[model samples]
Target: MDHKQSQIQEAEHAKRSYGSLLNVISKQYGSRDTQYADFSGECYKAVLEECYKKAKIDPSEVCYVEADGCASMITDAMELNSISEVMCKNRKTPLPIGCIKSNIGHTEAASSLVSIAKAVIALRSGIIPPNMHYDSPNPNVPALLNGVLQVVTEPTPLTGNIVGVSSIGMSGTYCHAIIKQNPKVKPTKEPASPIDFPWLVPLSGRVELALNTVFEKIEAMPFDEEFIALAHSIFKTEIKQHLFRGYTLLNAGQQRVHEVKPYDGAEKRPIWFLFSGMGSQWTRMGVDLLRLPTFAKAIRLCHDVLLPKGVNLLEILYSDDPNVYASSILHSFVGIAAIQIGLVDVLKELGVEPDGLVGHSVGELGCAYADGCFTAEQMILSAYARGRASVEATLIKGMMAAYVLKDVINFLGLGYNQIKDQLPPEIEVACHNSEFSCTLSGPVEDMKKYIDTLKQKGIFAKLVNVANIAYHSKFIKPAAPALLKYLKQVIPEPKPRSKRWVSSSIPEALWDSELAKYSSAEYHTNNLLSSVLFEEASAHIPAKAIVIEIAPHGLLQSIVKKSLSKCTNIPLINRFEKDTLKHLFQAIGKMYLGGIDVNIGNLYPKVDYPVSRNVPALHNLLTWDNVKGELISSFMKNKKEGSVIHSWDFIKIYDKRIQNFLGYKINNMEVIPPTVHLVS
Candidate 1:
């Protein structure tokens, strides 16, 4: 009755606030105080008869009726009207009238909401609960005395969409709310279109064991339309006590869990993209990614730009044939460029962006394209011309090997001039990879001899497992001019003069004159001849930056990890892993942990599955606060031990206090006393 009165008071306030915009009308009455005269039971019956006549709906349309059963008189009056509405329809089933108060006692101010909630549940579930009391009808009521209505004695199965609930205050403030299940709302049981790729499901638990339980429950269930919809509905929420964070990827073949270490005390830092060069390519580097339209489109774009030169890049990428890698270096280099570009597109979609970028050898071409220095067509042409030069130099029978120096010896313990004099003319220091490591290039026999000499001194050395011609050495210097000449014809446009570039060829700090020289053909020719200053360029990277290797494998990441002082290495792709989809998602999950915001909607470009629009079940967990005493308080003040609580309820409670303090109270009592002092 108090709830009904509060609704009346709110409606009255709305009338004063909005003037003519408010439309208030009196409805049927039902209440716990069953005295017919006090709660106006006759008005309730009149409204029900009038509604049935006006809407032309018989009582048979309503499967069940929930009445405010604070007393027998209130329920008996609603039952009488049900019979009057169905008199002309010849309906056989008596409308099952139930009262929530019979089962769960009167809930005071929550009585009306509870009764309405029960009615909605009954309509959805098709079962009407029995009125616990009143095995015999009230003989005083006209409906029972005349045999016009019957009381439901037990649980009954109902078969209709409409249900009705009523509540009335003691002073005759009557309310009636009719609930009708809309025919347009579809069932969630229907099968949806299959997802061709893996879907990520974010899970959160208060403890480590809770996470294991969550995973076990998911593993036991079949992957279905509802599961897919639930997976895509993940959202961010505040963590409470000891959160176990990570996500699982669901696919047709198998499921994989990518566990993120529970967040430690750390701050968000910047990130860098480290793109890969040649020798990272395998036969089918991007075969698994072909299902994605964005990736496939990027591959098609490369094919279109290079097919005129008689190369089909997709045939090699999608084919399992071992000869694909053996045929030509042009195909492999072009595939690397195409895959990296496609990866950049997908990363942007996932909301993981790089603050800066660095690339190795031909990998810099993709970086150049990303920063607007090279267009897609120009990048393809440049890769092809460089690969052609490399294939020509293979005839010289020279290769590159990486070596780590022992004891930080200066030029092998001899003076620079003496060491240069003793060394063979064919051997050259190809790469200053780091402070401790360098790559050497020469004829195969000279490389073997140098390795033997270094091993005799207890220095670590190994031959790089690549079949390419020796880069950054004099042996390939003859191939540079022709490659540079072709690049100039194919790319005649002027440079954009982007300052984001970091050169691997020059070891000095880049000046404006040097930046402009990147546009000239001689600059590129010199790049092919001179050693790569990778260690020098790495020094330019800012402090606390994270390096993400964008490649088919983690080959460059290991080198970068050893070179940098205090930086983290994240690999976007892994050639060693067989499940490419799971590996890619793990990289994304790690980025999220590193404080990057991911827009999950972009991950689903094709929304044929009709994902559920509902918000996730787990929400912001409660926190401790000191209110009146030293006792701990959660964000949910009225929450009990095992009941679900809502944030909107908390908001409503505070809103009422604010309203009382602002002088909107029914009584003159002040919420904030004048004698009490308040702190802001």
Candidate 2:
């Protein structure tokens, strides 16, 4: 042969050897053959006829043939032709034939042998191998192959009758046959028992050498209980060593081991309720509250509707005008407007809500709404009036600062009596945040004096860096008269109390009498003039109450926890936890359905695995110029020789190149190339 021809021959020889090896492995693993391009219909018929003759079986007497490896080629062609011929001639009585090759790939050299073996085993066990990977045949191939052969792809009982198997090789070089009936094996009976020795010796250890002086000799034992016990002893020793190693590793500083306490079943579990609040709002407040269907309808039913009185509630709350502040009205208006409007909407959404509603100052308006003392519109209007009135009242007084006091009551006691007596009539205590903290508003002189005294007493107090007037104090008392007048004329009459509702404001429970009392002008005036002692309210309800703090930030939640140690607990649920309105609704639904531990972490779909990884070499070969050309040349030559070459070989060669390029130390023998059919 010429050099080129010599190389081609070498390659072909290697390919045939590989195919042969695959066949051996397939047979060993119990694989049967189906049709392969390499084996044609004529070739299969010739081989099967030869097998029948060798087995001394007549064609008519042969009940079934479990044909493997190129077996489907003949069967398919015959079926397709027979169907067409039958339609034309109206004939019948074709021999029954089955192809196991359709289930597994062609086993090549051992193809017929494997199929015969499986058939024999099936005939003995009364089971059959399935024909797998058969969807539809190519149009170029005869359609007779499409559905002619009835190959059992699932486990099936055999009739313990005679069966036939056949294999055909390239160039009609090889064929095999087998004839078998059923043979049975009986099951063994033995009870399981524990081994006496608990320690296992490592393979590397010499028991005699380790024993040195003290050793005991044992006699030869059969492979029965004694042998099994010895094996178990060795296994146990290995396990013990492994456990020691694990313990050492765990004690190492690199590992972080947590001491987990088992759950105490007796511990009482508290009911968990997640809370949501308003979106972060700026500029305008309560404007949307007037438009809500629930709020609008409720406001209309109230006794004295305040919203229709030409009040520009939005502008008053949103504005930063010095005039509004000069009159000491901005803070109260904004606070009340935020609280009432926010609460009204929140209550409508909640319907029947938590044990207690916790608000961050302004959120108290929402609490009041839950108590049924104020309709949504009335709350918004009242807030607007409070803001305007407070701003007007605090125009001359200095700004208020939220002070963190070491002792809130002491701070309040020192200032409430003394500051009230000394400061101008315009100053006041805005909010009682906690027992130890309070916000104060007054003229600059009085504020400076109070701060100075607290500092000297070793109390840490800082001014809240805010622009609005100090609220809940005497600073806005002047505006209280006007506020009370507006509320008395415009505030809505109290609605009937609902058992489903609860208030953070009252301790016993919300009743019409209590709500009506707060709704009166006198009570409204007192609320405007005096600071809200949240510490006092918190002390009343000292049980585990669900406190939902409504605000943009967690500041209110933190304050509630610190102020109401007896009532509130940790992991305080808020609007931000739910993040979105839809999620908030879902959380509420889950809560109502009693799924307290529900968590919604991620919502995106998982990514899919890429197919390229499975056939990297083939993929690379397709993309590589040199590899592709070689593959095409090989394929074309094979076709001319009545044989087809596979692209998988090129993929394997390219994969080797890739491994070398990437500096991988993998053995070439370890690399498996994909199989493809090459017809000869």
Candidate 3:
């Protein structure tokens, strides 16, 4: 080890590579002359035997020996003789041998671990490099002359999976180990699929700045390298989920950050989905939501049902052509139904299923789908029929405008009742949306003039885009009979609705009437003609519910906030937002902030990995007392010392936190132990 006269120069002879450690054991033998340095060789032999037994390998299974050369003439020769002649006495041929000290020099205190690492590299590479500077055998060792042991003087093939290593500490402390290859090799993976969608990297800290620091750290990660693994690993770790949270959306090698928000919720509450009616569709609307497999599957299921009727829902929904993107009144109806159905399916698949459901106007079809009131077939067919009937009865032209009651009050100091009195004879209050909002319906000219009048007076109002057809008003009454007829053809009689469905059309007072079966064709016809009592139906939503809007745009977001101020409102999509995945996950992160367990695992693919049995589930959990100053002793099996108990009465012990033991409290204790000591 001292041959090179330089520590750095000596490391050149060592081989470095991956290794699988098997087992290690330590032995302490009381020396014969404890006052001096006399020791017995038999203790080391016993330790080597115990290590071989613990490794579940016989002495014959060891293909090579990692000699503790130490560059000592007497000790090296004696160790080799004991290993080959005494331990491996059954071997017929000389055993191959080498030492880590000969390559990396004597590392002194850390030499045991160094020897183990050396054996690991040899086992992994399946090759043992030559013993550095070795030429001839030492004549003092009888095993070398007798051909019982042979030093590895040249590069040799290291057969078998096992390698044995031995090293020594000062005095009589000896350690022996066996290291081998890992048994579980990774299986070959299948070809890649587009399973990696956007992931919400949840971040939290004790304070706002800490949250920002966490965001900065994640943003600086090498996401391109094993990104999915990175995402899943972050979830797998036992990091505390805190209230001050922020999230970054990861999708297709791009990321965007959502600013920090604090969660002050008492507990996770049930979720409710609010499906808004039309005025949110666009060409290529499904292009982004289709990225989710669950969403796409929902579309495919409904698409297949309609294909038999000369309608290709898939091609139409994803088509770039304005005229072909499910644009017809009938197909457009089906498209909206499909989008709502798909969004619901996607949310449920990610563990955010609704506890309550409500829909405005035709949005009821989605509510029915989730409530088991309609199948994929019944839902689309009904949409197609309703759309056809509505298109056929569009002779009377009308328009709609949404009004916020708070804005009306701010400008005109008026509520819905007062504002209705001022409206023209032809104008109608189509939807009493909430305590703070209502929608108006009338002839296009009248509606436009009324909206401009309101805007001129500093009131906030926006024309609802429904192609000059006012829903929930007399303008669409002519379509009632035909709509009922088509819906009857789809579901001939009244069908039971799931209790989860909360109708925006029928108020609770009418639940015991003929509209009890809300899924009936007659009920749908009434739904089209009657005003939407969304504010009245909002009473069905439980307190602290997370209300998610199932619409292309968050049309009912303001109304829901006004009606259910205690609930969290999450919009599934934005008509103007091109990055749908980012928008969707940020909403999910908001729900998470509201105490919803939005399944983190569902965002990525599942991977199979083998964890070592030795790894404790909670790494930081204390399983033993390590701070106690104590002595340990061992005896051979069946030896008389094994039955004997030696008790040394403790005189004194130091706790090292002595300086502050009895001091005034720094944090909690009023007084500390001045000097923690044991006196027995």
Candidate 4:
């Protein structure tokens, strides 16, 4: 490798070594200046002795010593010389001693660890560590002494636990650690309660304090059912707060309060319940809803509509059948079906109805059904037709995607206009997802080629994943004809408007009167093919309107939020799965009770969900407070065998506290800080 590459590799190796050591070392050792200190001969010997004891090895078995360092080369040499002197003078006879610094310039703090670690492995594997930079020893050390310690420029043989290492920090502290042959060790004992309640807060600043507080509480409190229940409640509240209002800590001594007085003049508008899309489903969805009589009743009503067409919607949804959800099409159908059914069931049970409703895409069908603009049969039939048409159209014609530049329309100005005219007549923009991103649908190969040409010109373009078929593109125009034909065959019926529903096909929200114009057979054919005027639609809405997305994925929510940020501050809601519903309810409840107030200590945790048993390790790692106590606890618990001994209960509390402070389960990466040392 070239010099620069070699340097980079060495640096990276050093970093990994440091990181591993930081993860395993005792917190006291890890936090001490010894990691970065300059060493005295005595300090070096003491460190080596500690390593030998920790590894359960006798010094007599150590046949060689190798040391390296950039900043403290002479100091390390003296230390190693002292080791040799101790061996001989104490009647242990003699051992070969060497230093890599005599060859390559010291690797600084990394040098000692690297050289010594290599020496340990050499002893275990029957090889020797090389001295790369050595030409001649310092004149201060006798030349005859060199004969006793071979100046090795090439690999040498080693055997058994025949290696010993010593490292000194620039600050006069030293460390020695031994590396031994791999040992057969038993697995760690499992915790009494395998599951741990980990915090999921997101703010970094508050994590430490939160964890500290939690650790103290957990340690003091008895582990009982009541305690667990309280823990669960606290966990749930915090999660809810974190999800709704991102994890944030209050500024020191800052306080703000709001006062409200009752208003008498105007009538309160009925609440408009917002439902979510997909991307929110988890296992055992709707189980909580089953507990609510109102929700159960609503599910029954949905069963009436969905079951007749050989769609056991609930069974299809709840069944642990992987095959059914293999594609976006099936996933979307199940997601939309479950949500719509759940919403209808919940509303019916509560006897609380919506004032208006709007679904982004497939959600629109649900809205139509809920609004009484179409019968459940008509809505499902329309949806099925739409779904089939979409799937087929996508299979035949391809899709288009663009990474828009800032001020997208202006950036593409002439280029976009020119492409629009030259493109296959079937292509059209489908969804404007973001200000700088849009999706297009048309010929597959043609779109690819078009994107490539743009990319060659330094314009960013790529296709959306999972959306292989273009829905809103002109290539699907032929499917429109089929849809039109299907719509004509279905008999129309006039129904009451139970709630207001918005149509993406039109700029204005659809009321009972507007339904008549779209009832015509021709409107379905043409309107279905045309792109929605989202910008115009956004402008016509109220600033504080609560816009709930009813699509399969929460993609529409993201789109609407990005597009309409300026016009309205509406809280967009998605009603996809049960967690989403819980979140939505929490949001609504908060808004109803009072506006959200973000106070650090006042924040509550979310309820705990039953996660897999395998999650505790990750959670512990992520949430563990890096405070001295917690760090020490973790080090003792997770260290290599014979490193340290600590109580299991203490470690568990420390782990939980760390999780609470971090506001999430710990990830493995979070367990060790960047400053940690991996090598002795």
Question: Best candidate per lDDT, number?
Answer: 3
256-277: candidate 3 lDDT, tens digit per residue: 5657876543345788988888
Give TM-scores for every candidate, taking all chains together and pairing residue i with residue i: 0.71, 0.38, 0.64, 0.40
lDDT of 3: 0.68
The Cα local distance difference test for each model comes to: 0.61, 0.40, 0.68, 0.44
Least well predicted 10-residue stretch by lDDT in candidate 1: 15-24
Per-residue lDDT tens digits of candidate 4, residues 326-420?
35454444445555655554444323455566443345556656666665556556655665555655257466464554443553422233445
Q: Which parts of model 3 have CA positions greater than 4 angstroms off? A: 1-197, 203-215, 224-241, 251-259, 319-327, 405-415, 445-461, 492-495, 539-544, 561-566, 611-680
RMSD of 1: 9.3
- Pairs in clash, predicted candidate 3: 405-436, 661-672, 661-673, 661-674, 662-672, 662-673, 662-674
Which pairs of residues have clashing backbones in candidate 1? 32-70
Rank order by TM-score, top first?
1, 3, 4, 2
Predicted structure 2, TM vs. truth: 0.38
lDDT of 1 by residue, 1-680 (tens): 01112232332232111001112124634454655445444576666666555655664666666776667564545545543453314656555677888888866557887886676456544567777767766655555555545556677776777776767655455555566642332355544445587766665544456565665566555555444343444433324432345566666355456564453213456777777775678778888777766667777888898888888888878888876765666777787888887777787676666677677766677667766677777777788887777776535766677765546545342222223355678888777666666677787888788778877878656665345567778888778878888778866864753556667765564545564346445555566677766767677777767777777666676567766658767787888888675677777767655545566556664443222222111221223344657532233322233222233322343575455556523357534433222221
- Model 4 spans with C-alpha error above 4 angstroms: 1-308, 319-331, 344-357, 389-395, 400-426, 432-437, 452-467, 485-491, 494-502, 507-527, 566-578, 590-680
Name the TM-score of candidate 1. Answer: 0.71
